[model samples]
Target: MASEWVVAKKCLYLHLPLALTSGGSFLYMEQYIVSARKYRPSTFASVVGQQALTGTLKNAIATDRLAHAYLFCGSRGVGKTSCARIFAKTINCTARTPQGEACNQCDSCRQFNENRSMNIIELDAASNNGVDDIRQLVDQVMVPPSVGRYRVFIIDEVHMLSQSAFNAFLKTLEEPPSYVVFILATTEKHKIIPTILSRCQIYDFNRISIADMVKHMQAVAANEGIETEPAALNVIARKADGAMRDALSIFDQVAASSRGKITYQATIENLNVLDQSYYNRLVDAFVAQDVATSLLIYKEIREKGFDSQFFINGLGLYLRDLMVAANPATLTLLEATDDVRQQMAERAAKLHPTFLYKAMSLCNDADFNFRQASNKQFLIELTLIKLCQLLSPSPDESGSDEGQMRPLESFTTSSPAPHPIDIPAPQPAPAAAPTKAPTPAAPAAVHAPVQPVAPPPAATAYSLGGLSLRSRGASAAKAPTEPSPAAPAPVELHRSKPYSDADVERAWGTVRRSFPAEPMLTGIIEAAVPARKDGDSFELAVGTPMQADIVGKQLATINRTLRNLLENDSVELTVAVCEGEIPPAFWTDAQVLDHIVANHPAVGQLINKYKLRLD
Candidate 1:
């Protein structure tokens, strides 16, 4: 039945044209052209977003200083081939315009436009990139153009040519006939051999700016009788990512979906783009430190089927734009329309510059970790929470110890109200008698109430490991009233006494014993006993630079502890790396066994009975 239907359709199509001819009417079907090719730049003046390059080429042609070989380099869809073609047609035109453009009325221009000109040739090197193809191209170079002054050969994707092909064509490319002009266009110029690059005049094409693309698309939409919102056009241009070809293609898709009326809502829905309004609202939630609202917004985004990574990257870009808009000098950096940029600036005004910077950094971290994250949604939610915390007042202006997280309740709109408590002013304790090492006592806490005192400052809240909440209220409440200035407490003077080497060694042992949790540091300190050099100065040598650095970092703490232990206030200690082999700090298994046998003979017997070896 399918075959019969096909046969009938073929007969209908064959008869329809003949019937129309018999009726003295010919059916001319209109071919639908996509916006990309339909609006492709023809003349140099018509080229979009490439004024400087087009002008240079026009000047070269007008001044009759055209090079025998030219190289055009840029990313895809940036008018490399288009400019090459325009340059070729203009140079070969019998009658040129005063602006250095080809007069389309001339025979050369008309033939090139209609794709029948023998003077111009286009070779797609991506497919024919072998030695034989280069040989064929080289053979064709020998014959000049029959109709025009110069024969132009435009090679597209010139980087795809094989090494052998490049070597084979190098000679001809370097010294082509005077009438032959070679134009090489590539998206990746690094792949092309240096010989080919050196033989040509290189022109680096700029990426079509978003503003340029949007403006050009507007003109195309008008000509196509399609109504479009400026916001919709901006979205399309950004989606293209600096590619005019891509922008026009996206425009065609959106126009079809919207049925000739492209609105912002319809455009985003068609493209499956996350709305910028989500980011705008998210900024508000961050400023308010509203974690719940931010999380809810993330949930809504997930429900709309947007990937978490894409959402995070988009958020980072939005924050970056906000940061850029926060400064007037950088407002031009935003690639958005005036109205959209103005709205962003207004919203950015509400956020602090520091907050925007930190928020952007958080978003960047979330984006970088998105691919490796097992729970992508959770990562995004946590990032959003961190952004909210950026504006929260920190404890003593130092953020949480856990680095980017704090308890949600700790962040408040304002400080909590202080409460009054009646307590007696505590008496000062007597100073301790100087011993070998005197430990400072903590301030005494007042228990019973005697006289009224001023209320303490509001307790600052903090989070421990981002898990539990803690506050300084206990210490703040126990703090005694300030003493009267008439009878001030006496100050204690530090002791600077003379000590022997034995005293220094004993003090070093105490310091080493204190680092029980850090065995490496303990071992490093024990490698050498500090010796007095001059006055109260001393030095200790370690095995390596790393050990020296470790000891250097703790030198101040060690000096303070040692000075207190020795009752000397002028103690100074320095660490030095030794020149030779480092002494072993850890005991080997054999040494341990021998030491155990020497200390307790029964341990060796037990090891022998168990047939155990420490290796």
Candidate 2:
């Protein structure tokens, strides 16, 4: 007996430790739960950032007004399937309370918790999106629930359902059995056909608010006994963009990266986020018109592995926030911490409204063109330079009027008071004596016979109209001189008579055909009537200064063309603004020119001479 007891003691010592070690390993394994499943909302009340959706579902359950087919559409991770499962449990719970909540103490709820529920079915349509899979689902829908009152079928990613599968499932989806309930969830509702959309009650889920996400994350951190900063959690919440599941996933990543204590710096570094300080400094530089500082901030961000495109896009969004904060009505939309919000408000106040508008426009343009730009860094730098220019006063208006005016020093001064000088008037010179004298025997001979020299035939003067020409010696010697070899014979000059009303009409018709399709010129041409003609010079009356200027500028070109057409180089053109019976095409270049000069003097001056009409 003593020998048996010694052997048993040795065996017990060895076996006891092995059994204890196995139990210790099991205990350690049991301590951890993945953040995803550990934080999944177990009850309707436990869900985060979906109070309205959950409340509506609860009210429906309470009123016993359940739809046969329901559709939930939203971005991913915004509580689609979780709501479906909760709805399934609430409706089929054996011990459902009067308030329409499932009692966890019941056998049916326990089966659901254990993943053994017979009435609820989930199908991932992304992988099983075929006619056969849908047919199988239809077949299952025919069967009654064995353990619950209603059979719930949850189809996830319902948008992925094949066209044939959707068609095959449509009849049953529209008219399922009284005991059947179908819940479809998808991120893209547009992909789902209109027929399918028409048969279901759609619920659109919104992105979770940052405050709500942070509150839930804080609750999670508290439950896990992890330390976190509110600022750090706020960053994670914003990064999640309104999806609670995404927030929790990010929380897990950040918590792991930080070894359970998340600081703002750790969160930013782990996420590879450009620091807010950089954005703040950039904005400060923009406010102060500091291009060098803005460029330096951009360089630092680039060095930190942030893409220039993303940096520009983020800067655009930041400016947009500043714009929103500039107004009290839009301040609510700015999603930042209180401290950051106050800083934005202060910065917004310092910026001019027009400057902000122009800055925002520049940033947005840079973001849009960043992708196509060959030298993207230059594009960003140019955008900063433009933003800086916006803050400075325009060069045209930067100085006072007095500073722009010409100074007295620029004027040329006259030489000091020139003295008067005395001068004498010149006397006329005496006439010279004749070189030869003739002796006459009789008075008739001395007087040279006193015979009148008849004027030459070429020297005889005749006037055709207002113009006349005479030979050079005709006035002095009263006789024509022989034509010189070097000089051509002079032709008589004649004045042109003024055109009659009929003649004026004929000339305007000629002008009209000259400019067939130019409306402004055509209109003016049609409105013009000959006012007067003086010695080959014609004048046309226009109703306004604009028309006068137009015709006046075109006068030279028109005159040249008219002279070539009419074989008359002496023809001249004149335009004058007058008050008279306005023609049908009464708008003259004068009125148009006046308007153009009024609105755009530079354009007017570039195109034609402008004269302001005085009323």
Candidate 3:
């Protein structure tokens, strides 16, 4: 099928007339032209999304600084070969424009445009990629152009040439005749040998942006007498994924399907894309913490025959776009049409930035584990459930605890209600105590009731990683589910109960799990052999001050966890060096390997028997 498409595309570009047998007569039909070939750039100024490259080529031509060999590198349909053809024609034209474009009226330009010039050659290196082909090309280089000043040889898909073929062509490419200009084009630039790369002046082409693609498609539609909605064009542009040729092809496809009147609904249906409404609805469900609604939305999308992985990936991208749209500075990065962008912007305004970040993170994780998941739907559903939970407020005890999660700051609406708990006014500060690192003073006793102080009526909503799903209307029946803040209290260190060795051990074990990313720190915590002292402070025994320093940096979080787990508010942590206890960094790579081997002798035996080299 791919070969057939290639053959058909070649036939189209070649414009081979078809012979049709009419009644008692033979007739030749005009060749059919695809949009890609029909709208292919004829001049440097006509290329899309490659201004820098076009400018450089034009400048080089104007300045008369052409190189013997040139390499145009980029993905398909970014106009590498088109530019090469344009450049070749421009350089050979007898009457060129001031902007360095070829004059179509010139005999040389006319002949090249009509595919009758012998000055240019195009070789498909994918098929003719052997040393003999390179030798043939080298032989052709010795012959001067019959009509133009320079003989231009364009090699398409040049990376397919074998190493031996590349080597065979290297000498000719490096020192071609003055009249010969070699132009190499390839989608995979990295596969070309470095020797070939060094010989050519390489120009990298960028992918066409969605905006550029839309603008170009609009022009194409207008010329073709087709009517299209901006939203429909935007969908086509995105579906093209940065290839102008692809965008034009899709434009043609969509144009045919819509019968010259394209709409967004028609596009999504034809493309088999999940509806945009799913994203909007799911986002609302996420903000509301409505798990049931979110799950139902997933079911509807799944019923539409969309792949779970594809849907989840799209959801991740949607969340990312929301994150980008949430900030004014990054709004320019949102690639949708104005109406779609405006809708996204409104959703972004209501969404807390942290919530978007976490939501995106959850979706990204699910996407990463999608292939390994035992139940794909369950994985997707679990991700949605987690996203919904992010909007719910966590308990003050759990939320305030070290390593515990809290709902992201809420910004769902204009006005946010205050928490239900009555927050007492702060008391005046007492004079500082003489002791070092003196503890905060305990609050004075309060017998009277405190009132819940609300934020100003005009104030915006704010919560922790997610929004409070409070009722938008001013109705008392609909209650917000946010947890209350803790009462103002201070610790009395003197009245604190002492923790036991067993309690310390248990607390240490539980606290260390919080730093799974830092296994080294976990190991240090275990090796330190912390012992309880008579004072509030507990000491960690280690070999060096460096280990102590490492532990000290994380001391605050560690102390908080210990204090919570041990049920004591007055827990202090410090490190004391004991030289022989822990080795600093396990000395070297070999020593580290030895330690691993010591833990499991079978691994060491396997290493020795296999004669493994780590590098």
Best of the two (1, 2) by TM-score: 1
Top candidate (lDDT): 1
Q: What residue pairs clash in candidate 1, if any at all?
A: none
Q: Which stretches of candidate 1 lie over 4 Å from their true place?
A: 1-28, 395-615
Query: In model 2, what lDDT does residue 419 have?
Result: 23
1-615 per-residue lDDT for model 3 (tens digits): 565555555656788653432231333465445688889999999899899999999999889999999999999888899999998999999888998899988889999889988889999999999999989988988998888798899999999998899989988888889998999999999998888899999999998888888888888889888888888888888888888999888887877788878788888888887777899899888866678999999999999899999999999999999989878789878886666677788778766665787789999999999999999999999999888866432212111222222222221111122222223344332333111121111121011111211221222322211211211111111111222243112222432666666666656655544443333344446443445554665555433333344455456556655665665767666555432222424343333433454445565444423323232
User: TM-score, each model?
Assistant: 0.63, 0.60, 0.63
By the lDDT metric, which is better: model 2 or model 3?
3
Computed on alpha carbons, the lDDT of every model, listed in order, comes to: 0.69, 0.65, 0.68
Is candidate 1 or 3 superior in lDDT? 1
Candidate 2 Cα deviation (angstroms), residue 297: 1.9
Ranking by lDDT: 1, 3, 2
- State which candidate, 1 or 2, has the greater lDDT: 1
lDDT of 3 at 45: 90
lDDT of 2 by residue, 1-615 (tens): 565455556657665422223223322223655576688887788878788888899899888899999999999888888889989988888777766678877878888888899889999999999999999999999999888789999999999999999999999998999999999999999999999999999999887778777788888899998999988988898898878888888899999889879999999998877777787788777755577998988888999899998888888887888888877788878876666667788777655455566678898999889889999999999998777655332211211111111110111111121121222233332233111111112221112211111211222332222111111111111111122233332232333444443444444445544432233443455545443346666555444444454455445445543443344556665664443333324433444443443455464333311111111
